[model samples]
Target: MRNLLVFCVLFSFIFFNSCGEPSKKKEENQLEEISENDNQEKSESGVILFFGNSLTAGMGLDPNEAFPAVIQQKIDSLGLPYEVVNAGLSGETTAAGKNRISWVLSQDVSVFVLELGANDGLRGVPLEETRKNLQEIINTVREKNPDTKIILAGMQIPPNMGQEYTSEFRNIFPELAEKNDVHLISFLLEDVAGNPELNQGDGIHPTAEGQKILAKNVWEVLGPVISE
Candidate 1:
């Protein structure tokens, strides 16, 4: 009878231990999955905010086909992990971009590509106002994110707008870039600005091929800052 009780007790011990092993393993697996997810979130590279208007919206082209997208592809191909946020709103002026600058800067961005002033120039907005708004945007970004890199993409007004006004608008970007000690991506439309073949029918937006070149133009300046 004592031997029989001993045998029963041993059987119960073995059964409970066997049952507890799988449960412990399941908890460990759950903990591992949570840990992996947290690690991935922490490993993600910083954000790139492209703030501008239709030229930025890639009007007449797919959003994913925009120059920003091209830059993203280049970054990926080079195996640099980063996120590109297209904050382009069609027909948005520098004033409008300024209005939203605070909200946009709320994101944890590593870089900013300021591509406004085009719509302001197109609409004949006062060059001083454009300069002021852009300067404020730059100053705000710098103040909020001291380490964020900025690339000022320049824009030119059409000749019909009179050379004085045109030159003032064009010079805003470089001047601000210099004042802030940031990089300047001269002429967002470098290869595609005046070329009919490169521009879409609107003569403002770029063709698909043109967008690719524009992306490269911005990348030339941006790549270096981000690469480092």
Candidate 2:
């Protein structure tokens, strides 16, 4: 009787341990599977983030009407495998953009379109400061994702700021693009700027019609980059 009791106890202990081991392993495998699924989703849904000020935000227009949204439509139409995230903030300056860039780059960005410095120029922030801020932004993006394709949008301030400052500001984008070996959009506003019909009442933000032109301007450079 004593031997039979000891044998029964040992059998129970072995049975429980054997069951527990597989359960623990199964739970571990499930957790690993979930982690892999999350990574796959992130990889498949890589984003093309448009980070900038009011122009990128599409101020005074419906959220869908923004140039970034317009670009999203275009991307969808073409059946591209990327999502567009409009990270534009109205009235944002270069200094503000520099401060926020690190947080903005936390996501996985396949393509980064930077449209800033217009507010800095309008506010008459130091030209050198603007250039530095822009360079830092590019650097931060590169650090986050070396493979991310960058497109720098050029901006121009009104002559009221002075020719020297405007010229320097205008040169900042191309110089940064060439220095960093990134794509450059010669002028963000292009045909929209100085056109009363294309601008909002403030003569700064683009009208809906103007947003289309802005979309076209971005698409010209962006389309080829994404295609490659």
Candidate 3:
């Protein structure tokens, strides 16, 4: 009787363990299928690759209210059809952006907006390094597709960084734009930067209204590209 009870317990344990595999496998398969479906949806719609840091990530605001979202809304309202593929990773530096350039450009991108380098500025990384990373990304994308519309969103360092350093950082954008002959938005947060109402508590990221202004800023530069 003791032997039989031990045998039964062992059998139950083995049976339950074996049975769990199918359930686990089923869940994994379902998740994979869902992911594939989402990818298909994104690909079919059309793609706008947005590579940047927190500003592009829509930090402190809903995804729908982010600059990308605002751009999508404008696209929709104007009957300009395209998908906004937001690849903005908050806290990413230009080096990180450089690392991911190939992968982002590999996609079916109608337009590419490069909004990185802010974190690099904030961290006081070498301006040359920031410029090189951005330049490499721009060059690589152009190599992949010569006609690809590239928008370089410029950023300004805080005044506390000292006028000399800040001036050098500020000049990076126009210098690159002039060299590359690509479209430039000048400053990503032009009208809202110092405005307390347009920015969040951090005074860095934009509020919802600020995002609208930003989207408008980008559109003023990017609108003609898509329109043409």
- TM-score per candidate, in order? 0.86, 0.82, 0.79
In candidate 1, clashing pairs total: 0
Q: How many residue pairs clash in each candidate?
A: 0, 0, 0
Q: Can you list the residue pairs that collide in candidate 3?
A: none
- lDDT tens per residue, model 3, 122-194: 8889989999999999989988988788888988878777788899999999999999998899999899898
Top candidate by TM-score = 1
Candidate 2: lDDT of 134? 92
Off by over 4 Å in 2: 1-42
- In candidate 1, what are the lDDT values of residues 1-228, reduced to their tens digit? 445545655565567678874354544555566667667865687899999888788999999888998888998898887889999889898899999999988878899999998888888899899999999999999999899988899888787789998877788888888888989998889979889999988888998899999998998899899889
TM-score of 1: 0.86
* Local accuracy by lDDT, each model: 0.85, 0.89, 0.84
The candidate with the higher TM-score, 2 or 3, is: 2
* lDDT (10s digit) by residue, model 2, range 1-228: 445545655565567688874344544555566667667866887699999999999999998999999999999999888899999999998889989999888878999999999988988889899999999999999988899999999988888889998888899999999999999999999999999999999988999999999999999999999998
Better candidate by TM-score, 1 or 3:
1
- Among all candidates shown, the one with the greatest lDDT: 2
Order the candidate numbers by TM-score, best to worst. 1, 2, 3
Distance from true location, Cα of 197 in model 1, Å: 1.5
